[model samples]
Target: MLRELLADTIMQSAQLAERPEITTPPPGVSAHFSTAVAMRLAKQEKKSPMEVAAAIASKVQENAPFGLFLAVEVAAPGFINLTLTPDAHRGVLAEIREGGERYPAIPRKGGRTIVEFLSANVAKPLHVGHLRNAVLGDSLSRILEASGEEVVRWNYLGDWGTQFGKLIVAWRRWGQEEELQKNPIAHLVALYVRFHKEAEKDSSLEEEARSEFRKLEEGDAENRHLWERFRAMTIRGIDAFLVRLEIPPFDEDKGEAFFEGDITPLIAELQERGFAKESEGALIVPLDAYNLPPGMIRKSDGGSLYLTRDIANLRYRLDKYSPQRILYVIGNEQSLAMEQLFAIAAMLKLDSAQLRHVKYGLVLGESGKKFSTREGNTVAAEEILDEAQRRAVNIVNE
Candidate 1:
């Protein structure tokens, strides 16, 4: 409030075309507030910055209302610094007191924000890497919601593509009903890992998996049913993890599959609009103008790529939510892919919404190695739960 008052005072005294920028003076500056309005106006008036600053300081000292400043002084170059009177500081406290219990709330800006995070592929355990994404995204959603924005916490599960096809093949070959019922995600993870291991031994398994995915895309009833079962089981497991960790549930769990139908139409539009061209039998959006590599939208096999789905997702978000901001709380390793996504969006000339890739770093194990499935090591789960419970108890007692 005081800074705003100071800004208003500067705006009036200097007769500024716009309100001047005001800020808290850094320590050792010996002032409560500071502005550089005079420096910005110097070229307009054909006067040196220091001369302009002195003139504004004199006028502010003479006309500032409410006894706001104990002293108004001109500092180096063109900074006009004000040392506030005690009464001015007391007035700020009175304003805060009037705000009462609702002080944390902000004025509404009339737009929603969607934070998509912890988007771990289904059929995998929630690991340390996913933990960072969840915590950061959940915290950010809370902060934005408190700031009076309607926030949608989304978990865009990675439920589509060749991986599921391979899993379906693995299920038919080796899956047991008992094992699946025991722990769905863990069993799916094992079956998927088994598929990769067998694929190493038999080269034909790769083609078989791809064929299964094609059938799935064509809506084979058996393949679609299996995929739905996988998704349902995985969501239940993921929700249990979130409950134990106290992370909130997502408003939407629609995965890459949600935008699958839109991709074909989108690709056609891109080609029609001259934004896409065929390269090596794959559809790509050339990004030479953006100083980036070509962004592949469809693979040579006619499978829609993640980039294509992400572009469709952006369009869907605009149509469905019209959010002011869309934050992708992803990992740092995918920075380049995120760059490509944004560039491709620009190529398509999609409606504008702030698309931010809020990247986070890896979670190092106790031995300092990044956690990997192939490495066969996991942090002590009981230890983490114990520590969390202890802290929770302490909070309750206090």
Candidate 2:
């Protein structure tokens, strides 16, 4: 409105002086109407810029065309500054009141958006690192929803992988059923930690863990049951912590296992499209064109990798939701992997959906080291929240 008023005044002033009509204000003119156009006009008319500004200001004040400006002053060096009127402010308030919550929302032109986050492995507890992922993703999802975009808050659980096989082996060998029943998540974490420790001492355990994981992948009944029980228990524990943190419920809690079936066919399709190739008895999508390393879809041991499941997940999401945007709220370290994944998606002609990796920095401990479960220096999400609550209570008591 201010720009329109300034444009009209400039045009009328030019006509009055029998000069070339100024249709638009200079580039420096903002929504607040700060313009150096008067100086340029003065040079063209052989008059002082201040004199020309005063003339334009006088014409605008007399006409009071839109009554938008409370004051239009000719500042030093012929700069015009406009102050919006109380009436204009009142009008904005009225419009805001009429629109209510929708007043400042973005138009709902874009389609749905899927925000995938927190994706912690079921074999471990929700740690401090997961907190960063959760907070960033949850906040972004809420903001998108508030801005009038339909958002699907998704938690892509790391429920399938080689770690699960190691976890299964650890559970079968040393896991006490009674202890697991008493406290599932803590017991699971202990099993995971113990597995790594044992693997470090006896290297063959690594291959054994891999074999167990392959069994889980190959539809071994007992291993599948164990994995499902572990996943369910971990999710319940995660939910309890999420409630403490006030993170809203997820719209979908689809694990990597949900898209496991999609991997084999997707790999074949990629191979057929010449996007994938056999390299060292494994299938990989060459990302050399994108300046990234090849994305491994399958290992030499017939093991499906995260990239394989992710490709399947992407295809599934594109087919089911048809979202305009898919956001992966992952760590900065996975930037290269995400770039490679999206590049492969493009190679397969899956370029319709916008893929983004919202990367965040690490959440370091007080000692300035990255949190790690293997190091036994990691803090659980629940413990952090409990400490925060304790501090808050202390402050309230004081």
Candidate 3:
């Protein structure tokens, strides 16, 4: 309101001086008003900038129509500064008190946005690395919604992949029903860590894991049932952690497996459009024209990779939600992969939806190294929250 008043006063003074081209000063807190319009007018009128400023200031003070300013003065060469009356400040505060929560509202014309974050794989527990992703993504979604944007908080879980294959193998070998009943997520992480250790000792374990995963993918009843149980347990664990942290529930919890059937058709369409080509035994999209490395969609083993699943998932999202933009809150390490994905999407002529990768720096331990679950050098998200709660309790008692 103060800004509007100042602008109107400046504009009126300019019109009265017959200098309609003179621009009004923008409202600022550092000074009530300041503009170089006087200097520009002086240049055209063949007079000193200070002289023009004085003439404008005198005219504005004489009118003083609103009487909302303590003083309006010409400073230095051609600057105009206005000090608001004390009543103006009091009035602004009273208005804010009356308005309460709806004091300020900004409207956005853009359509709905999908914010994807905290996409942790079900093979492990939520770690310190995921904390940053969750906090940043959730905060951004809240801010966008507050600014009048329609937001979809998406949790794109990494429930499908080779890691799941290894996890299945480990769980079948070492998983005990009693331990799982006690703590599902912890038991699963232990199994996952053990698998890596055992696979290191017996290289053939890697092939076995792959085979088991393939069985799951091929609709083997036992493997499918086990996978479903693990998925459910992991989701339950995630929900508990979110509740502990006071984070809101996700709008969508779709995983990569949800789009498994879409991969074939998506790849076929890419190939039909001349975007995909056979490179060696794998299917790849050549990005030489874009000065980027080729993006591999399928491996020599005829297995689809992350790129393939991502493309299919993007297609599904565009078709289902028809969002104006898709924001992926991920680490900086995946910047190249994201670039390649967007490039392939563009080549496929899927340019209607905007794709954004909101990359953040890695969260490192005190040793200046990245936190890794596989390396067993990471802090669990639950532990961090527990420690914070403990400290708060101590403070309350004090």
Give the candidates in order of lDDT, highest first. Answer: 1, 3, 2
Count clashing pairs, candidate 3.
0
lDDT of 1 at 62: 73
lDDT, candidate 2, 114-136, per-residue tens: 99999977868788889888989
lDDT of each: 0.84, 0.81, 0.82
Per-prediction TM-score to the true structure, in the order listed:
0.71, 0.74, 0.77
Stretches of model 2 off by over 4 angstroms after superposition: 1-110, 366-368
Q: 317-342 in candidate 1: lDDT tens per residue?
A: 88889888899999898888899999
Put down candidate 3 lDDT per residue, 124-187, tens digits, no spaces.
7898888888999988887787777888889999988888788888988999999999998888
Alpha-carbon RMSD of each model:
6.7, 6.2, 4.9
Leading candidate by TM-score? 3
Best-to-worst ranking by TM-score: 3, 2, 1
- The candidate maximizing lDDT is 1
